[model samples]
Target: MSLAPILNPAQSGRAGVPCSVVGASCLLAAASLLAPAIAADTVRDRDKAAIRAAAQAYQEALSRGDGPALAAFWTADGDIVDEQGNTLAGRKSAADATKPAAGTVRPDMRIRETNLRFLTDDVAIEDGTVEVGLPGIAQPVRGRFSATWVRGADGWKLAALREDRLDAPSDAETLQDLDWMVGEWTVVEDREGRPEAAAGDKPAMEITVRWNANRTFLLRDMKIPAAAADEANQAGTLNVTQRIGWDPLSRKIRSWVFSSDGGHGEAAWSRDGDAWVARTAAVLPDGTQTSSLNIYSFDGKDRCIWRSLPTHVGGEHAPAFTMVMTRKPKGKTP
Candidate 1:
């Protein structure tokens, strides 16, 4: 019987072969050619899933600066070649990398653009870039890497890692986000049209912001008219000078603030959506420590809102205050 009717029973109603022998042979040959071949040398599907799990764990450990945990991701004799041509092997390979070197702050490694291929059932190769979020250095560094991952009795482990090139982006470009803050601003009514300068809450504030000569720092001078909010402002018109700049060592935008009444503090600035939040850690003239969250958000080019939410002040909870700030008219003096 011709194989055509047997293979494709609906081709003809007759049970016996209805096609010619040559046609049956051609159909059989075509079906054979379309058959999938399972290669023994290729990676198993389960193994690929395991490798992905290990990669995720690897990134998590590296970010938290957990040295011992990072070391566990590698094989017993695994090694790494850094961008500088230095080689480290075994536990030292993972442990040493997590240690923040000089000029680096919290060098967190994140693998990106990963391409994984199986060399064999038990071995895989991965090519990607490792972006290190090292805050203290001025330049942002990205290192291209090729890693060898091997499936072992326990699980997948990194057998070798090589970082060949390092690319860096200019640090100044990162500071451009704050350019909108460089202007003179004075207090306005709150966002809800409520006055923030209520009794015993906050004084009226006017701030003039300008860029330093190098354009690397923001110079802000604030004048507060004497009010009942604090003893310092009640004595006279309080002047507060603050210099905000990018600190390469800390990998943060840092500000140093000094008040006319001898109160001084520093804050690390970070972005939260459309707002900039500064967590200030300050000490009063009488040696009392205080901390507050200062949030600055914008409505447009000419107006913004500032909120001082107190977390701690002399071991008591002080009321949080909010105010709207309008940009002063050009060439106008207060």
Candidate 2:
């Protein structure tokens, strides 16, 4: 007697079916069933990429101050809930609210995606950080934003956007206003067309700014190799260690800088139009008191021009000089 399980012809509606034939049929059925699932996964991944692209477009529009372009990222009836709880309903309202005044400095806004979840093939939820600042603003506005994106005939559009202001910025949050400076930068003295370059070898300054482990402060280290070679002057190799942080007591952004040459100074930083103005006072190693106004203007993410106007130094005022710094690519040694 063969001890094999018999196939029920009544269940399969086929009689006298070979086991091999049954196995092949089952495999074919599974392939047919999985094909649609595989196709669906591919479609979902494409949709996610499209949605993220739309988010980037939205940020670019904001940075360009193009209110219409910004609005086009949203659905016709889309709504925006701002940090103050004011709602701008519909595309027109949202666009008008965001339109910059004539001649106003464009806000430098950056968006970083934190989370993205697909609710359906055509719908998704995105959470991100939005940091915005104008040239003269002491600190950029930092906020959290959550958006609902929906896919339609025209691709993904924001169905709703809600922004919430972060509680009074932590020490780290304020430092984030200068986050663009968190990198290695080099100043090529001769290339900058400055009069100081007429002197031999024109000193080059390398600056490195980095965040501490907790990111509460930005540590800046600046080195001028030429300064060290000046044997006659004790200022040996100008190395300055600086820390930038938010001072809660003063409710201001400040920086303290100490140089290897026994020079120490502090600056209160503020925004002035499209520039950052730092009013600085320092005591030189020779015990001479000095004061200056330093203005920093960013040309873009990688380059900034800094100008210093001396107000007092040895009781003599001096002309302002400008220095430009360009960011060095990561992992590149100066």
Candidate 3:
């Protein structure tokens, strides 16, 4: 995301009046008019940074099980609202609630700032995502948090904090469940033959999955080399990109796919027992609509199986097919 430059109103003048004239009284007036706004902006930026640092410090304290240190980041009268909608008033109460039990391991926590809105130079509202990983839990617990920050002699301090546990799984948690698939994988064997292979085309397929820089989305890319002359003259080959993320509006795990062959798809994913399923609908270049249910099962970290049940295509149903995928050997090139 690119931000537009913050223009100085003093230098830009007001109401189309020119302030560049030599010894112009209008220039002084413009400068006077803009001084408070400029100062406020500067203070807001500085406070935002301070509040973020304070949040990070609190996270560290939590990781280390330092209840006192966590309390130090808050104002003397700061309060906290826990996920269960219970309020712990006063910094001491908040600190006591954060303290880990004796001989217990502290949960690892990571915070990502999402928004900061300044109501005044001395106060601001902060929103962030919190990910917590506890011992014996397969996946981290994801939640959202909001805090009211105040500027005092010690700089920004959390005056009030509220945490809410998500009733539905977050995109990060959903993606993390599939993190085992983050690697290069190849189709080692196909119990059912590929569609192109049945047409006497020995096409090759490769798949790679990785996380975006912020680990907010899983990006999967697949490529199949053309095995026929007619297909070669078209798009370089069969290339598809899939992005898996949490859809806030749908409140579900969703994916969008785009292909070089002018095909695109949208899928809503769900978990069934040990397998993950994606119900997908795609539109082809020729305006044909196709729908399929794809089931993905994991054998282990290195092996998985995929089954595609084509339920509808141009008003016709197709048989289901399955394929096995094995993680590419480490240090091996394709």
lDDT digits (tens) for residues 262-311 of candidate 1: 99988767665567767576666876555555778776588777776532
Full ranking by TM-score = 1, 2, 3
What value does the lDDT take at residue 130 in candidate 3?
71
- TM-score of decoy 2: 0.44
Candidate 3 on 217-246: residue-level lDDT in tens? 899998766652137355566788999987
> Which residue pairs in model 3 clash with each other?
none
| Whole-model lDDT per candidate | 0.65, 0.67, 0.65
Model 1, 262: alpha-carbon shift in Å?
0.2
Regions of model 3 farther than 4 Å from truth = 1-173, 192-203, 228-236, 312-319
Cα-based lDDT at residue 183, candidate 3: 91
| TM-scores, all models, native as reference | 0.45, 0.44, 0.43
Please report how far candidate 3 places residue 168 from its true position, in Å: 10
